[model samples]
Target: MKEVIRSADPRIAALIARQATQNRDRDQLGLDRISALLEAVGRPQDRLPPIFHVAGTNGKGSTCAFLRAALEAAGKRVHAFTSPHLVRYNERIRIAGKLIEDAQLGELMDRVLDANEELGASLFEVNTAVAFLAFSEAPADACILEVGLGGRLDATNVVEKPLVCGIASLGLDHQAFLGDTLNEVAAEKAGIAKRGVPLVTQIYPSAIAERIGEIAHDVGAIWEPRGLHWEAGVRQGKLRYRDRQGAMDLPLPRLPGKYQAMNAALAVAMLRHQSQIAIPASAYGAAMGWTQWPARLQQLHGGPLFAMLPKGSELWVDGGHNPSAAQLVADYAKRQWTDRLPLVLLFASLQSKDAAGTLRPFKGIATEVLTLPIDGHECRTPRELAHLAESMGLPARPCSSLSSAMTALAKPARVLVFGSLYMAGELLALNGPLPD
Candidate 1:
């Protein structure tokens, strides 16, 4: 699938616009294109700093955020690359703890495009090459790479030797490319495991964990799972983590949602298990508060979008599109909304997503739903989404715009906007508090 991206800078916009005309090798999933592109550009991936690679259906981006926060807290200059930018394309590549400047990004994009225009590299492949090129030429202490999709043939998986590898919460997503079954998906994600690298992961069901372990073992990776090698839990509002090295009590993540604690712990475990990085216990505590990943159960302040809601009502947004992610959002709503002011969902989804499976989790929890359309991309019609929600025993209505949806609500209620990252980006762009 072609990723939708826009830029205010014309130079960058022209470069991105040309991508639409390029050959999109969606059916093929091998390293031939990316490897060839890298070779044309002098193989910058070989000169990168000690890397921390992460992969999963969800939480991988948040895991990378925690890793960058903790690494920077330890006084290290970190370079990170994540996907599906919420606001700007610059959010995908952070060079030396700052977003890549427009001048630098334009130059790099032009150079890479000119070097390998014949390779038919996808947009993501071009992004991966640009990030590696920037990280190699710059001076940084660490580099964090988040797998764009399934790890086996993800462009970011080109790294041969990372300092450590981690996998976050896994669920069924991108079944066409990854696999239909959860175990098959787990094996594809565990493909990032390299020989002698510490493959740290969250606790999973025995069957899923066994599948992951089998792949890791086949590649000679030292599998360090949560229950066996390291463990962490939230007790009395503190995150206590223990490994073979030692134990430490750290502050819970300042980011909202109960699942963020698990993401934070995975970062701590990855840092502690590695011998290359020297991260102090104090850094872990600082990271808990320093981490800043937007649009994951993030509450809105006084913004254009928030202003549309009824007075005294709360407004929140999440970019969760899969079944597992929807369950997390539903669980959070049940736990946090003690007053029960009635739950409303402003939802939209891509055409490729399982709309019914995504809506199944909120069957009984949502009081009402208003469906909207995602502009400039292939998406499910609002009427289609409304019908899906209505079929699940939830009252739903199709609206032309979010503005109209807010106007239709006569009562004050907590409004949660979700369904797709493209919609999340549209929300953040319209409102304030853009991702930094």
Candidate 2:
């Protein structure tokens, strides 16, 4: 999918606009451009602190959040890079423990873009180069990187030797770039495995696990999978985690959804398996409450958008656009709202996503689905989406806007606005508690 970015700072915006015009293909995926770009900028990837590189179809961002939270709780200074900013462009790069200032970000953008005179680098490549440059020049104990797409040729994969590498839950996403089958997608993600580096991963089916183990063996990486190397689960009310080093009873993550516990466990395994960083057992317990990744089943309390709903109504939002992610959201809603309250869905998805697969999980659970169009994106038409939903026996209607849909709700209901992350960003811009 093509990425669209805007900055409030004029200097940054101008550079992004110029770069967008120079490259005709915005979604180019390869390490050649990024490698050359970094070479031109002094090869910052080689000068960074201990790095923790993570890649997967989903939950990678949350894992990064968990890693950051745990490190910060240990009183360590950390740098992180995540993609697809929710509110502002600066959200993608965290310099030590805070977002990069506008002046510094603009300067970095100018430097990276100026170096890309003839490389025809994609926007994401430029973003990666800028992040690496900033991270190399800063002082931090660790740097956590979330892969932008499939791991093998992704720009973030330019880092040769990371302290530890982790793979979150595997799923069939980006089929056009990765592959068609589940094994193919798993191979693409496991490509991050490096020689002698421990490749920590979540549990997968037997066939998929065998495929990943083959790749790990080919690369000479030590495969540390969940079921075999470490185990974690929610037992009685707390999280029970056990590994070779020792066992600890950690607190459950503050983030909603039971799946978050697995993401947190991955972070713990990645941290414990590595020898470069020293993390106390207490840090793992504290990380459960400190971790925060917005737009994944986030609830809105007060804002311009929140006031539009009827009195006593609950507003929830998620940025899940794939079948696997949608299934999680559906399951969570089924468990949380079984008290006879009406469940309404405000949905939108990009043209690249599987709209039918995403909407199929919410068919019997949602009382009604109100379809909307995503601004500045190639999204399915509201009418077409409504027809698709209706065909699946889900009562749906096309609405002009979120305001109109919210206004049409005559009584109190539990409303879930989900699908495209762009739509989630739009809602955050109109609501409170933007991602920081």
lDDT values of the candidates? 0.91, 0.91
RMSD (Å) of each candidate, 1 decimal? 1.0, 1.0
Models 1 onward score TM values of: 0.98, 0.98
Stretches off by above 4 angstroms in model 2 are 24-27
lDDT of 1 at 153: 90
Cα lDDT tens digits, model 2, 1-436, are 5788877788888999988876655566778888998999899999889999999888999999999999999999999999888889999999889999899998998899888888878888989999999999999999999999989989999999999999999887789999988899999999999999999999999999999999999999999999999999988878889999888898899999889999999999999999888999899999999998889888888888788888989998899989999998899888877888889999998888999999999988999999999987889999999999999999999987878888878888898999888888888887868788
**How well is each residue in 1-436 modelled by candidate 1, as lDDT tens digits?**
6677899889999999876577566567878899999999999999999999999988999999999999999999999999989988999999999999999999999988887668878888889999999999999999999999999999998899999999999999999899999998999999999999999999999999999999999999999999999999999999989999988888889987778999999999999889998998888999999999999998887788778788888888899999899999998888878686988999999998988888888887889999999988899999999988988898999998877887888889988888998888888888868899
Supply every candidate's count of residue pairs whose N, Cα or C atoms clash at under 3 angstroms: 0, 0
In candidate 2, the residue pairs with backbone N, CA or C atoms under 3 Å apart (3 or more residues apart, or in different chains) clash, namely none
lDDT of 1: 0.91
